[model samples]
Structure formats: C-alpha cells, structure tokens
Target: MSIAKRLASQTAIYGVSSIVGRVLNTLLVPVYTARFAAAEYGIVTGLYAYVAFLNVVFTYGMETTYFRFANRPDTDRRELYSRVMTLLLLSSALLTTVLALLARPLMSLLSLPPGHERYALWIALILGLDAVAAIPFARLRLENKARKFAAIRLANILLNVGLNLFFIVFCPDVLAGKYLAGLRPLVEGLYDPTIGVGYVFISNLAASAFTLLLLGRELLDFRPQLTLAPLRPLLQYAYPIMLMGLAGMVNETLDRILLPRWLPEGFYPGKSNLAAVGIYGACYKISILMSLVIQAFKYAAEPFFFGQSNDKNSPRTFALVLKWFTLCCAMLFVGVSVNVELVARVFLQRPEYLEGLAVVPVLLLANLFLGVYWNLSVWFKLTDKTYYGTYIGFAGAVLTVALNFLLIPLLGYMGSALATLACYFLMAALCWWLGERHFPVPYPVARLLAWLALAVGVVALSWWLPVAEGWPRYGLQALLTLGFVGLVGVVEGRRLRTI
Candidate 1:
C-alpha cells in the first residue's frame, strides 16, 4: 500500500479512538455547562490546564525517545523498552508523590476551594498512571498495533465518560428522586454532590488506572533500573523534548491558566474573571474538531515519519501529508466557524458561554497552524536535532505569555484566543524556515496558504451575508462549506488522484 494510504489508514484507526472517543468525551461539555455555573466549570478548565503542563513533566519525552532508540539498528528494542518503562515508572512515582505531598499548596496556587486538595492528589495519580502507560501506548504505535491502541484508548474514554455520567448525572438524579428512587442508597454510597466538579478528576483518575491495568501485558517484562547510566543517551535526547513539551504546553494552555488571574474585575460587564475562563474553555471545545484531526495525525505521523526517515521520497511524502492535513483542517475551520453559533449552542448550554464564540474560528485556525508545525517538526525529530524544537517551543511560549499579558486585560478571553493564533502561526512559520535550512521538505506552502486563505474568506463571507438565523443561516453555511470543499476538489483532484 502507498504511504499516503497507510498514514490515512493509521490516522483513521487512531482517529476512531481520538476523534470518536473525544466526541464522546465532548458530550460532557453540555452536561457540565448545564449542571455547573461558569465559575464552577472554570475550576475544571483551570485545573486541567495545570494537568497539561504536569503531564509533560510526568511523561518527560521518553515516549518519543523510545521510538527513536527502538528504531536504531544498534539498539535492543526490548532492553530499550524496559529502560524507558523503568525510567517512566520511577519518575512518575516520584512526581506523583511530590504532587500529593504538595497538594494543599497546589490547591492554593491554583485558586481551588480551600479544602479541595484531593483534586490535586487525584490529578497526581492520573498523571502517574498515564505517564507510566505512555511507552506501552507508544510501543503499540511503533509495532503498528493500531487496533489495540485504539481499543485501549477507546476503553479509557468510554469508562471515563460512563463514570462521569454516573457520578455527575445519574447519581444526582437518583438523589433528587428523578428516578430509580430505591437505588438512592447505592447512589448515595457512590456520589456526593459536595464533591461536584471533583468527580471530573476522579473519573479521569479511575480511567487512567483502568488503562494502566489494561496495559498489564505490556508491563509484564519490565525490569527496574535505578542507575541512569544506561539511559544517558536517551535522556540526553529526551530532556530537550521534555523542555519543548513544557514550552508547547505553555503556548497551548497558559492562556487558560493566565486568563483568570490576569484579567481585571468587571472586564465583561456582569462576568467574573473565572466566568470568562469558563466561557473561553467551553468555546475552546469547538476547536477540538480541528485538534481531533491534528492529534490523530500526530499519533500516526510521529512513528510513520521516523520509520520512513531514510526513504528518498519521504520529503515529498511529508509535503503531501501537510497538504492534505491543511486542506482537511481548512475545511473544518470554515465549517465550524461558519456554523459557530450552532456548534456553540450544542456544546455550551448557557447564553453566557456563547460570548466567546468569536474566538472559535481564531482557535481553529491556530490549531491548523499547530498541526502544520507538527508536520514541520518531523524534520528536527528525524535529524535528531530535537533541541531546535525546544528553541522554537520556548520562543512560542514566550510570545504566548507576553501576548496574553498584554492582551488579556484589554480583550479578556478574546485576547487569549488571538495570542494562541499568533503563537501557533509563529511556531509553524519558524519550524518551516528552520526545517528548510537543515532538512528541507518540499511542502506546498503557497497552495496550502491559498486553501487557508480561501477557507477564511468563506467564513468571512458567511459572516457578512445578511442572512437571518435558523435554517437560512445554516443552509447558507452548508452551501459555503460545500463550496469550499468543491473548489479544493477542482484544484487538487488530479494531484490527489495521483497520490
């Protein structure tokens, strides 16, 4: 089969787990928005932002390191796997311990309720379980065990969703005498309304633990290594990646983290700073339509690129991947942006949450640039110049921080959205420039930009059109979205067919 076909197939398999599972997970947005006030949901948003950062710390870059070393001709795959797992296991335990110990301080730092230190503890456990499982999941990717990887991921998401529904929805309903009144005793044993948003973290912790258990076979042959000598080379390669991951998280999530803290009181009339965060966070879910594609592609592309690193035609193959990736994401950008109101209403159950809907398009485009950056980043990875990724990541993170600081007080969450877009665009552009110098890929930059521009133009036209709400607006959006897709087909049909 062709490389394009293989990547697409792998992406589809991964997407089933990522895209499908996230769609299931995204169901919780409406539930959460419906059940909790903006201030309450903000806690979920804020804590998870910290989780993104800590996850980078916990896993540290060993997954990619494992892939790199495992692919080396001189390396023993099993020993390498064992070493990676050993390091991850030990580090995750240490980090979890430290996090648990500092849970109270973290609660204060994160501005959580005074007594909710258990949230930090639950997050610590979740991170440790997930960090330890990283290599096993990466191994599945490396071995082309996409089905098993998807199965495990899907199981985790399903279980998380089930537990969330049980605790957040069903248990509460039973207690309220909505139904199943006799089961109130059983429900009472499981659910506490006072626990409230903490259940989100608990559900995730349970799912992560369940996932580690399901990965038992992958863990069976693990041999612990206390000394760092054998892992020096891997660590040397991985630490830079971990740094990049840290900076990347800052770029990706620090806006959410900083928005509430930095914004002035009464920035949005009646809304509090945390309420702005809740709005931004809920609206941010709309962009996951783009991120879902990016994530699945990343899962497949990382291993695919590494395995194909030596192929003479790999650059052209990489270029094609970016082209198709951009095309698909551009379509998504246009589709989601044009129908932002509909999408917002579906996921955000309150009128206040809709205030940030304007940020959705900016974020979708930002995520598209992010996907492009991921494709461009394959160059540094394949060349083992991963430190360049670190540099670019920090540059973007610095820009993100500076931009958020400058803009949040002025524009509120909209400032955060703009900062994200600018940051990702810079990262993608910088990566492409650097990749050209070190390891050039024949990326179709002009054509890709044209498609992006067209997508943006279509969305703008949708906004400018004096169409009334309801089926007319939606019908117009449908036509415009179709029109963009059709134009891409006309322009790229022959090229796509050749691929």
Candidate 2:
C-alpha cells in the first residue's frame, strides 16, 4: 500500500476513537458544570489535572520505548512486548497498593475538604488502570493493530460516559431519596453531596478495570524477560523521554493544577475561585477537538515515523507528512476559532461561564503549534538526538512553571492560558532550530506560514464583525467557519483529491 493509504487507514481507526472518546468525555462538562455546581466541578477539574501529570510519571515514557525496541532488527519482538508489559503491570500494581495504604495521609496532605478522602482513593485506582493499560495499547500500536486499539479505547470511554450519566443524572435523585435516606446517616458520617465528583472517578475506575479484560491477547503474546542485554538501550531511550514527557505534561497541565490555589481570596465560603477554574476548564473542553486530533495523530504518526527512520525515502516522506499535518491542524484551528462562541456554549452550559471565550482561540492556536512541533520532532527522534529534545522540553517546562508562578497571581485564569501558549511556542521553535542541524527536512515553510496568516486574517475579521445576541452571533460564526472551509478547498482541494 502507498504511505498515504496506510496513513489514511491508520488515521481512520485512530481518529474515530479519539473523536468518539473526546466527544463522550465532553458530555461530562454538562454533567459537571450544569448538574453539579461549578465549584464542585472545579474540584473535579483540578483533580484530573493532577491525574494527567501523574500518568506521565507512572508510564515514564514506556510507550515510546516499546516502539523503539520492538522495531529494532536484532530484537525479539514478542519478548520485547512481554518485558514492557510486565514492567508496567508490576509498577501499576505497586503504585496502586502504595496509594491505597497511604490514602488517609495523602488526602490530608493535599488539603482535601472534610469528608473527601475517598475521592483520592478512587482517582488513584483510575490512574493505576490507565498506567497499566498503556502497555498493552503500546503493544497494539507496535503490532499495527490500531483497529483493536481503537476498539478498546472507544469501548472504555463510552462505558465511562454511560455510567456517569446513570450516576449523575438517572440514579442521583432516585438513589438519593430511596437509598440515600438511609445512606445520609453514612453520608453525614463520611460523605458530602457537593463532592458528587467522586462518582465521576468511581465510574472511570469501573471502566478502567473493565478495559483490562481485553488485554489478554497482548499479555499472552510472549514470556516476560528481564535480561540487561535488551533492557539497557530501551531504558536509556525511555528515561530521557520520561524527562521530556514530564516537562511536556507540566507545560500542558500545570495551569489547571495551580488555578485553585492561585486565585484571589474572599468570596463564597467553601470555594469562590473554584467556579472560575471550572469555567476556564469547561471552555478548555471546547479546545479538546484540537487535542483530540493531536492525540490520534500522535498515535498514528509516532510509530509510523519511527519505523520509517531507516527507509531510503524517510526524510522525503517526513517532510511531506509534516507539511500536510500542519495544514490540517491549522485548518482545524481556524474551524474552531471561527465558530468558538457556538462551541463554547455547548461546554459551558451556563450564561455566566461565557467569560472564558477569549482563551479558546489562544488555546487553539497554541495546540496548532504543538502539533507542528510534534511533526518537526521526527528529526530528533529519527536521528537519535533526543538529548536536544530533553533540553527543549525541560526549557518549556521551566517556562511553564515560571509563568504560572509569576502571572497566575496577577492575571487570574487568563494567565494560565498565556503560560501554556508561550511555553509551547518556545519549545516548538527550539525543536525546529536544533532539528535542522542534525537532520534537515525540506519543510514547506512558505505554505505553512500562509495558512496560519490566512487563519489570523479570517478570525480577526470574524471577531470584528457585529455579532450581537441570539442567533445572529451563531450565524456570524457559521459564516466565518464556512469561509475558512472555502479557503482551504481553494488552496489544497486538488492536492487532497490526489492524495
């Protein structure tokens, strides 16, 4: 098959799962902010932010390690799969056990409110399952079993959404009255209704555990081995990526972690700043469409590009792939930005939460640069110059932390958005600059800039146009979105057809 056809097939499997997964997850925004109070949803938001950071720590870059080693000429691919899977399984079991034992102190350490300790417990298990699940999923990717990979992902996510609806919507009131009338004694003893976000974690925990049942084939593929001969290079490659992944995650998620503490004091008793955090976070979901594309692209592109590293036409393919990736991502940015007011409403679910509409565009463009940087990063990955990636990612991480420290106190939630955008922009530039010397690809510099510039012009005019209350605003956004589509068709329509 042609490379384009291969990519198309892989992308379809990966993209459908991602789109479905995120869209399912987005339903939680309504479940959270509308059904539950915004302050309560903020706690949910903040906790998940920590989950994202911790997940990177637990997996510790093993996915990339699996890909790197499994493809090497001298390696026993089945043994490689078993080794990585065993490592993750052991680590996940140990981590979950440790957290469970220390749940009491850990809850107090994070300053959980009265009667919220179980919240810590449930999320820890969810993270554990997710960490272990990473191994089999990576194996699937290694085997090019994206269809099975997508199936597991979609199934797990859909189940979680289904259960969340049951608990938060259908069962809450009924169970609250019938079982809860008896349970309120226990509730008063150890639970809080406002902390209903715990049920969200509980639903995820069930789904995560259920996902494990489908990993049987991957686990039975080969016997586990721990000889130093094969393990050393994989760890060497993985350890640096762990640093890079950590730094990258901090850049992506530190804001969500910091916002609750960093906001100005004095308002509602339990949480005033939390509502603001939830509002910012809900708007963040609107940008999840960009995140979804990046995720699926990463899944398809990483192993694909890595396996192509030794191909004679690898650089040429990489260059072409990077160009197309940028154009598609930038068009997505334009699509979301042009119609953001409409998109924001779906996630926000409340009139007052509209304050976060401004950050949507900023976050969208930042993700565009992030996706571009990922494409450009094939240089470092293919050339075995990952130390440069470490440096770039670390620099971005530091920039993220420093910006949040300096600005969050001053500018509130908007500061977090700025920090993220700045960090990603710096990291992308550093990767490109360092990449050029080690392994240059003839990137379509002019075309990329042109697409970006066109997006800016269209978005600016769209924003400037009168978009008052009611359907007119939605109509204007729709028109702007269509204009972006029309422009894309003009520029790349012919090329797209040929591909």
Candidate 3:
C-alpha cells in the first residue's frame, strides 16, 4: 500500500475511536451542562485537568519510544515490547500502590478536601492501568491493525459513555426499583443515592479493566528476558521525553487548575471559581473536536514519519502533509467558530454557559496553531534533537502559567484562552525556526498563508451574512464548510488526486 493510503487507514482507525468516540462522548457534555451547574461542573473540569496532567506523566513518552525502537532493524520486536510492558507494569503497580497508601495526603496537597480523596484514588488507578496498556496498543498500531486499534478504542469509549448515561440518567430514580427493567439489584442494595459522581469513576475503572482483558494476547507475549541492562538507554531517552510530556500537559491543562486560584475575587459573588472553570470547560469541550482531529493525524504521522525519515522525498511529503493538515483544520476552525451559537446550544444544553461562547473561537484557533506546531515537531523527534521539544514545551508551559496568573485575575477564563493561543503560536514559530536549523522541510509558506487568508475571509463572510439564528446559521456554516472543501479541491485537488 502507498504511504498515503496507509496514513489514511491509520488515521481513520484512530479517528473512529477518537473522533467517533469523542462525538459520542459529546453526548455527555449536554447532559453534564444541563444537569450540573457551572460551579458543579467546574469541579469536574478541575479534576479532569489533573487527569490530563497525570496521564502524560504515567505514560512518560513510552508509546512514542515503542514506535521508534520497534521499527528499528536490530530490535527484537516482541522482546522489546515485553520489556517495555514489564517496566510499565512494575513502575505503574508500585506507583499505584504508593499513591493509594498516600491518597488522602495527595488529595490534600492538590487542594481537594477529604471527601474528594476517593476521586484521587480512582483516577490514579485508571491512569496506571492506562499506562500499562500503552505498549500493547502501540504494538497494534505498529502491526497495522488499525481496525483492532480503533475497535478497542471505540469499545472502551462506548463502555464509559454507556455507563455514564446509565448512572447519571437512569440510576437516580429508575433503578430504585421504580420503572427500569434489568436494573441491577446492586444499585438499590449498597449504593448511595447521591453517588452519581462516583459512578463516573467506577464506570471508567470497569472499562479500563475490560480494555486490559482485551490485551491478553499481547500480555502473554511478554518474556522474562526484560532486564535492567537493555532498558538503560530507553529510560535515558524517555526521561527528557517525559519532561516534555509534562511541560506540554501544563500548557494544555493549567487553565483548569489555575482558574480557581487566579480568578478575581468577587468575580461572581458566591459562584465564582467553579463556575468560571465550568463555563470555560464546557466551551472547551466544544473546541476539543479540533484537537481530536489533530490527534488522529498525529497517530498516523508518528510511525510514518519516523520510518520515512531517511527517504529523499520525505521532506517534501512531510511539507505537503503539514499543508494539508493546516488547511483542513483551518476549515474546521472557521466552520465551528463562525456559527458557534448553534453548537453552543446543542453542546451545552444550558443557557448559563453562553458566557463562554466568546472564548470558543480563540480556543479553536489556538488548537489549529497547536496542530500545525505538532506537524513541525517531527523534525526534532526524527533527528534525535528531541531536547528542542522539551525546551519549547517548557517555554510554552511557562507562558501558560504566567498568562494564567496575569490574566485570569483580570479577564477571567478568557485570559487563559488568549494565553493558550499565545503560547501555541510562540511554540510553533520557535519550533519551526529551530527545526529549520536541523532539518528543513520545504513547507509551502506562501500557499499556507493563503489558506489562512481564505479561512479568515470565510469567517468574515459568515459573520457578515446574518443568517439569523437557529438552522439558518448552521445551514450557512455547513455550506461554508463544503464550499471551503470545494475551493481547496479546485486549488490543490489535482495534486492530491494522483494517489
């Protein structure tokens, strides 16, 4: 198969679980926004921000390392995977045990009250299991089992979503032996009435364990040959990558963690901190559709790029991929941002969070820049100059933190929006500059600017069109999305048609 076809297949595989799964997950946003107040939802937001941070730390860049080493000619693929999985299992088990022992103190350190300590425990276990499962999943990708990769992903997400709906929508009244059939007697016997929040974690835990069960074949492939001598270089390579993950996560999640600390006092009298986080977070989910698309592209790109690093046409091909990715994401940005009111209404199901509508465009655009930055990031990763990623990520993290501190107090969550944009843009420029020094890819600078120009024009026209609410706005935006594709087809269609 052609690399492009392989890329498309892998992307679709990743996308099925990511984009489709997330689209299903989006169902919960409406439920959550409607069921919980912005303040209540803010707690969820803050908790999950910590989840994102913890996730990056637990995995510690091992997935990418797996892809790198597993592709090498001399590496014994199964043994390498077995060793990696062993290392992850031992480390994650030790960490999980230690964290469970110290859960209460860690909760307190994270500023959670005693009552929320169990939340810490549940998520820690979830993250640990996820960390251990990472290598098998990467093996699936390496073997080109895109269907299985996507299937497992979709199954996990579906389980989580289905359980959430059952708990939140059905557990309260219907399962009290009231009306719902097949209702587990367990719900009535030992369950607290108000443990809807806890059920979220329980569902995730169940699904995570199930995911591990599905990896039985991969797990059985583990050999006892996993020893310390062979792992030293991998760990050395991974340490900086882990730090880069940490820094990148901060840029992505700091706003959720810091809004409570940095919001101006009396911002909304009694309902300030969590409310701000909740609103920002709800609107944030609306923007995540773009991020999911970027992630799908990354999954397809990482292995492909790493393998193709030595090819003569690799630079030009990489440049075109970046161009295409940017144009496609730009279309998404304009489509979603221009008619956001419709999306906001359907996504949130709560009128109260409309305040965050203004931040959505900025967040989406920020995500587009971040996606572009990611494509550029491969230069350093391929050349083993990955220290550059760590440096850029560290700088971006500082920018994220400083901006949150400076602007959240003044402009509220919107400050975080601006800060995120600034940080991503800065990193994109910095990475491009540095990567050019080490490995120059001939990215179409002028044509790429034209694509952005086209997106700006499309958004301007949409804004001026005055579609007048409801279906009209969405209808016009849909047309604009299609029209942008048609326009792209006209400009670059023939070039892309070859393969």
How accurate locally, in lDDT, is each candidate? 0.91, 0.80, 0.83
Tens-digit lDDT string for candidate 2 (263-311): 6675323547878777788888777788888888888888999888888
lDDT of 3 by residue, 78-174 (tens): 8888888888988898878776787787666446556877877898899899988898988887887878888888888999999888777776656
lDDT of 1 at 438: 99
Candidates sorted by lDDT, best first? 1, 3, 2
Clashing residue pair totals per candidate (backbone < 3 A): 0, 0, 0
RMSD of each: 1.0, 3.3, 2.2
Candidate 1 residue pairs that clash: none
lDDT of 1: 0.91
**How much lDDT does candidate 2 score?**
0.80
> Per-residue alpha-carbon lDDT of model 1 for 12-78, expressed as tens digits?
9999899999899988999999988998899999999999999999988888899998889999888
Estimate the TM-score of every prediction: 0.98, 0.92, 0.94
lDDT of 3 at 302: 85
TM-score of 3: 0.94
Off by over 4 Å in 1: none
